[model samples]
Target: MKLNVKKFENQLLQRLRDLKISNKKVLLAVSTGVDSMVLLSGMLKLSKVLDVEINVAYIDHQLREQSKEETKFIKEFCFARNIPLYVYRWEKEEHPVQSIEAAAREVRYNFFEKVLKENNIEYLVTAHHGDDQAETFLMKLIRGGNIQQLQAIQSVRIFREDYQIVRPMLIFNKKEIYDYAKQLGIKYYEDETNKSDDYQRNRLRHHIIPVLKAENPEFLKHVLEYTQQLTNNLQAIQEVADVKLNKISKEETLDYNKFVKESPLWQRILLERYLEVKGLEIKETQVQQILAMLNDEKKPQAKFDLNEKFEFYHEYLKIGIRIKSTTSLNLEENFELKLNQWHNLEEGKKIGLFKINEIELMPGDETLVVEDNENWVIRHRQPGDSLKMSFGNQKIKKVFIDKKIPSEQRNKSWLITKNKNEVYWILETKKTDLSLAPQNAKIHYILVFRKK
Candidate 1:
């Protein structure tokens, strides 16, 4: 079913008007596809009436030399229309980070974010139609995530700390986009991969979803309606879950005894809610751990090594987190050991000379000790930084992996350094680690966490 240009144009204009996106500079992440090209031209047609200035960009993924053709296509189209085009180039070696598609997408968005800082760009416009939304929902569903993961992408998202993202064509179906592009004589380059199951999203679009559509032609409409309704209730769900979970968590700590006693729905909700606060994803396995800990006879403990950043600790009736550094200490950056330090350390920092002094505290009490440790300093991670634990020598990196720390929090963790070896107090990062006696004296120095 082909759509007339005026109809699609009207819909686009209505979206822009509803969003109230400022009529300043809008950056289009153009891929030279039919969807994006059509969106670009529609924005162009609406610009005069809406008072919006537009900039079009084609991100050359450089996955293949053929991708360069997309750059050429978008460049030519923009040149013919007197629209400025920004092209970002990426070589294979430039992104030795992830798979080509993932790497390319990251680099491209990074390009846009960089451009945002330089130019007065107000919003980023994209051409993800109704079909794309359905595809995304299906993907999240298959992955077995809860409501937060399955929430539909917003048509107008506030992405930046200050700026925004606008998707004006979100309500339009792909058929409408295709027809409008054709009727407008818009030229676009179709990457053959889009039609193949080369990517998971494409696989769903090409293989899985078509069968479902054959069964229910109105699947997208129904799903969209359901999502609209869900959005209305999402915040309420979050609020109830937040309040109930906070109640059971008991001072931001999960008491498994109480957690297990709640209804299954509340338990799951609490688990999901707490994990979000702790910066951990509540995967099915992790959820199982929560259940097991709740049912245990004594205080239970479980740790997840989430990307070498932070450790998820759910034991002894509470959930605490620990972040371990992956490399040897970097002295340039200020690294402070929270539980290991001296009396009124002035600044909350680690690694400074202190005259040997005697301090006394119980095994479970907080003690601030100051001593002259020649090799100790607060620093960033370095290569070959090892900790000699009771389990023999192990790389802090390996410890991080075995511990299931989240990746984003790793570098933020401070280290206690002594000579070349790291003084890994409290199992790299633990709620509590044993502090050594001051200057080889008999007095045991223990800094307990402040009791709430």
Candidate 2:
């Protein structure tokens, strides 16, 4: 069934009017692409009938030569209607060639945003139709998404917030939309990409969906309707969850017993809310895993490392988050590394109460190394240090080369220091060491970066 203009216009006008955006200037995204061209035509019709004007903007991604011609046609079409046209030619230079499609889309949208900002355009309208919505739903399902991500495209998106993205034809199917465009004698540019089966969307449209629809003719329509209903239910569930969440939830932690008592649906909602607040989230399986620990004897360790920065722990039926574990020499600022003050290291717990005796070139078992006499900080080798090699007291750096340890690793290495100087040198001066020193009389220190 064809979509009546009055009905379509009424639906759009109602939404825009409710939001007080009916007569505002809209920057129509016209790629001479089918959907966009339909939108441009619809808006042009609307301008005459509804007393408004729309500025047409075409973005040439410049990936193909056809885009130049497509953009030119769109400009000409707009000119015929006396509609103001803006053409932005984007190149690999403007939008780097990496992930061409994604780059192109980003640049195109950014171009629209820029135009909207500069020209004081109120709304950025696009020609995303029902097929687009269906394809998006399919794409999201194929890739992955939670309930929210499944509804990939919103009917009305907020571009600037003040300038809304109003999709007038979201409810119309592709066949009807194309028929509408043809019936109105609106000329549109066709891109070969749309028909190519190489792209996932086209493959789904050309191959997967057709076969599926043959099995169940009304599958797309049913799914679209189901998705719409799902969206409504999702919104309602979210509202109820929000109310319960405010009443029952606590920051950094939750009452495990109380969370367990809630319905499974509510539990899912609370978990989502909790994860979102903590900047952390997990799969349904992980959520179930967390839930399963509620009745377990051993305090099960259920942890979620979010963005690898914050880590959440669910132990003893308690939920809490903390910073990630990093394995790096938490070095001092600039070139002021204090080797003497390294006694407080948790890593060196065994070498408790160790102190620096002397750090110097000495005739030792291994030649040179950094060991804790008490609990001194003997980190990795430094670049500029000169030490006696294990073999014949040669330059310790020569041993490093023989050891095949990278120069970078040697910068913060665990080199043995003795009394801040050799025992003989220290004995001669009787001077207390200022930095990394010999802790033990005889010990071989190898780079045990991590015990594991």
RMSD of each: 11.1, 12.6
Model 2, span 1-452: residue lDDT tens: 66575776566556445545456777888777668877666666567545566887777777776876787787677777788888888865766646778988887888888888889887887877777777888898988747777866776666745567877667666776677777777777677778888789998888777687779867666767777788788779778877876666566577566776788777777777777656565776766765565445464445655455876565534555678667666533122124332233234321112122343222321221335433233443444444533322334465545554433344444443343322211111111223233555465332112211
Global CA lDDT of candidate 1, please? 0.66
Residue-wise lDDT of candidate 1 within 153-232, one digit each (tens)? Answer: 66766665666777777687777787887787888878777877668899888887778778998877777777767876
Off by over 4 Å in 1: 22-24, 80-82, 95-98, 158-162, 243-264, 295-297, 300-307, 314-317, 324-452
TM-score (C-alpha) between model 2 and the true structure: 0.62
Q: What local lDDT score does residue 407 receive in model 2, on the 0 to 100 scale? A: 39
On lDDT, the candidate that comes out on top is 1
